[model samples]
Target: MSKQAATLEADPQLHEVFWIMAHEPALGDNLARIRVSKGLTQEDLEERSGVSVSTIRKLEQNDRKSARVSTLRRLAQALDVRTSDLFQPSPEPVSPLDESVHTDLFALRRTLKPVRGLSGIHMPDFDGEVTYESVRTSFLAANALYREDDYRAVVQTIPTLLLEAMTLVAEAGSPDSDRAARTLLSQTFQFSAQALIQLQQYDLAYQAITEGIANAELADDPLLGAWHVFNECWLFLREGRLEDSRRAALTTAETIEPRFSTGNPAEFATWGWLLLWASAAAVRNNQGDQAEDMLALAEAGAHRIQGQELEAPPFWAARGASTFAGFSPELIQIKAVEYAVVQGNTARALEIQDTIHLSGKLSSSTRHRHMLDVASAHASEHNTAESWAILRDLRTRVPHWLRYQSFARRVVDQLIEDRSRALRADQAEIATFLGIES
Candidate 1:
């Protein structure tokens, strides 16, 4: 057998180096292997991925245990394969749970790539009569469910809703009706995309968003286009295209700025929310100065929108959605704190946390998101007690909120791995919640 095939036959867990590379040796090996297979030298990788020759060498030599997921993605794209293909297990047999997760991911990629360049969701035919208002209302309901952290509930609701929206799109006769149908259809697909991402179905999530983007463009709604880009930033971040995500965030925020004005609260909220998204992308990109600058700009916009009579985007009247609301200031701070935690600025994160108003400054989902960031900040500082305390509080208060959130899960995993003690109680709590353990 070939080396990769031999390794796989010997031990399915003999990973090549996947997204989260906790094991250095396997990562280095896979990096070198993929490089050779692509007929690229370290210099070629450095030139193509902009990762630097020394850094590439360090990764291949196992001198560096981890690089940003974005860096890996750049290399993978240059190498011409899915990013997951580079993952190499640590020569250990895969666990049943890991196997199951991978199996599902494999199946998801298979099911979604039904055809080539363009995509559409395969929803069953809607037998009932469909109207724009009804489809819009159901989209709003799905948004409400999403903000409430009921992801699976949203997933269950969307397939039929998608069909109904698609049906409406087909049957609309007038220009106004056509616009309404297309926007609702676009928004519904966006919802489907977000739900799938939350559930960690990345490939499928991407396909859904691709369809959403196409529909958004067809609808020709600036706000829908902004929302589409916002979600695209999230997908790019997850897939480690940090630069593209950052660029999209910055550019798209600017793209929708002209739509905002003092007279229109929806447009105002939409622009400010896009700024917040730009800040989010900057933070993920580790551009501390740029992140701060973006947040400052977003805060200024938020100040303008806060006291005005708040209005949501008519098309996406999802409760507690960042875009539709009249700019939640605390929402921006929550993301900043989350970014700070990731950057290992525990003290700074804590200081920002103090400024966030606990008494409804944010939605329930957002407040909990901030709290999750606090827990992660503590965990990053190796303050096990504080981290677990925040986690436990979340489990008690907003029990379902963190369960499906990928960021929350990643933080929990980091906390468990970084903890000094072997007690692993927090680990057990998260494992139980994830159904990975009793």
Candidate 2:
């Protein structure tokens, strides 16, 4: 307790009330002290533990008296210390789900077993009559839907496209036509994997990706085959198999490197993109050296594009590029920022951040991530006020985005902990939205 918080007891003995208040450590101090010593900014903890920043702050400041056991548990997990240590470790034992509750976004385990032998009614034939041109148009439409991040639309459209492609394969009377049909089928499966991955259905995604790879090889389309490599890398990353992810990405890069000298926009961006994914995967897995090597390799490949987003059909999209600027320098720096943050090099990340021009250079999801990293950097530097300011800006610009992002929630939690009035109302709303008591 601080000097002003003291309370005198009536006719109290020497070992009574006054000494108790004076000697006992505040819960807030313990939480704050340990948090700082461990080099964790509140934002990092929020992302790791899903605890709010406000609760952590208040516990440190003594602005609040009590918190739930769950909050302490989360803080403990993020800090890599025992819950018992937080108390008096100098006040309360830390660690759980007090601040917020989230659906496990990357959980691979299925909840309920599937009902055995359940079958749906057969639907009407897709397009009634199938043709090569019709199937090709549908495939392109599915690709467009994927680009738009409309996973549901892609899911809805693929059945018709897949049915048509299968029809084409069956009717292909010549070896050449048969190969063409298989190639189209491969592309369809690749897209199915992409859509399912985004939807967080990993098992089904695995099946689709496997089938896609098989079809690609038979069709003899190296570009689509390389795409399968990219998809494989992506899947492993999400599965938390960092080494496997890195290997897949590296192997993909090696397999496709022979094609890089062509400067064909399709191959160039795809290669650069795979390398970037490798770098990102390495960063998360503590393979900093590998991440650096991957980014350097990616930068070299990005250079091959020469700042032009070339759309050579069936390789690069005519309407959309993989990234906002088409595998350009801005994209490279943004990825570098991600790596730097993971390395705990906030200063380097910030320096890189300043160099990049973000205007019109990012998609909504990508831009939100960039700002979240910026907020984390400031928080790590112990510049709480400035960090909160950045977070507030993020909230104002993308009000609903934070609610879905674990990082954003951490920043919101911190602002609330600091007792920032500007953040309280928002906090109440977010807490309610997350189904946690404010």
Candidate 3:
């Protein structure tokens, strides 16, 4: 099936299965065995399950660690077994859920205890102590790391943590774990939101932020509610929904006042982040006067909370800096390129791009995205030679299914379709980039 059709027809269940297989390395191997025994090729399973072939490959390679639960149930049905059968890891731990829960909890505790002890702080008493709150804390920790651009350290582990939290919540009969699970789910939403944004999947990012808000409400977490609004507004800003973004930010600030204002450092810090984000939106929309006012508010808020640090929240680090500290160099470069395009200044855009260095610290995935952006900006100016050259360089480092591939291809295809003089002038370079005839 075409990629678009496959996405539209994707089975949520199989997606969950792949999610599971991705998390549980042993389970993935087991599933692979089952598939082979059933005489199914990767393509066959992709057709049957509506999971992309690439995901199937990741599972069989034992490269991914967790998947969505909905996917597991579907895979079980496809394999003709109960969901329980999929988690038969050897050297059985107390319970699959507990094992999953404990792994995350231990890692978080290890990271936090030293900080707590050094500060001579007393930890809060657990109310129900069903491991719910502890798991929620773990999600927060992961979020901090994610926000710091430390994607490689936690990306493999977050999916499992989220899946485990979801499972626990689903099985809870009372309202006991509901709040904690919801909090954790909000973190999951944030993680997914950031990932989607990185991929430039704006619609999906909006969906994630919306879900995060729902989870925050369920958890009765006002701070998360504020965060949800802030991020949702951010999505709007990125998509040029400027008015909507401004309204959302203002509404969030109104709701978070006095209470959230005097709360934890993180809470106060979030207020700063929101104001900054909202200000940026205003600037984008040409609300120049409003933009300056909002930016002043953001600066004042950030200044108020400066140097106040906690153990740090998950995903908040990367997000925190970007939000309160102002735009990352990455996003700034993108905007510069965009502005150059708008002013019909292709040469300036290219010049600006040359100075916009890719972070040596960025992950392979992030680096690929940066290069694609550069290529795209060049393509926008009909610099076919330069665009094609950049795309060719990128193709060597990125995979076939990387999201940016579509963007780069769209540019090239449009150029070919136009059949302008530029196309003839750079046909060889274009052909080389497209791997076609000149």
Maximum-lDDT candidate: 1
lDDT of 3 by residue, 13-72 (tens): 000011112135677777788888888898887877766788778867867444433345
**True-vs-predicted CA distance for residue 395, candidate 2, Å:** 7.1
Candidate scoring better on lDDT of 2 and 3: 2
| Clashes found in each candidate (C-alpha, N, C closer than 3 A) | 10, 17, 23
Query: Can you rank all candidates by TM-score, best first?
Result: 1, 2, 3
TM-score of each model, in listed order: 0.70, 0.63, 0.45
Superposing every Cα of model 1 onto the true structure, what RMSD results?
8.8
The lDDT for every candidate, in the order shown, is 0.62, 0.59, 0.52
Q: How accurate is candidate 1 locally (lDDT)?
A: 0.62
| Candidate 2 residue lDDT tens string, 1-438 | 221121111110000000111223445677788889988887877788787777666667777554433355456667877544565311111111111211331221121112234584333344567677888888887777765554446556766666677678878889898888888777777766665554435566677677777877888877677776666766665444456767777787777774665557777776777787777766665455777888987888777776575553453321223341456667788888766765567788888988988856455556667777777777666666677676666656655434334344444444455553554565466534433344
Candidate 1 regions with alpha-carbon error over 4 angstroms: 1-124, 144-148, 259-263, 315-323, 359-361, 406-427, 434-438
Residue by residue across 240-281, what tens digits does model 1's lDDT show? 455666788788777667533443666666666666666565
Among residues 3 or more apart in sequence or in different chains, the pairs in candidate 1 whose N, CA or C atoms overlap within 3 Å are 14-89, 15-88, 15-89, 16-87, 16-88, 16-89, 17-87, 17-88, 18-87, 70-240
Higher-lDDT candidate of 1 and 3: 1
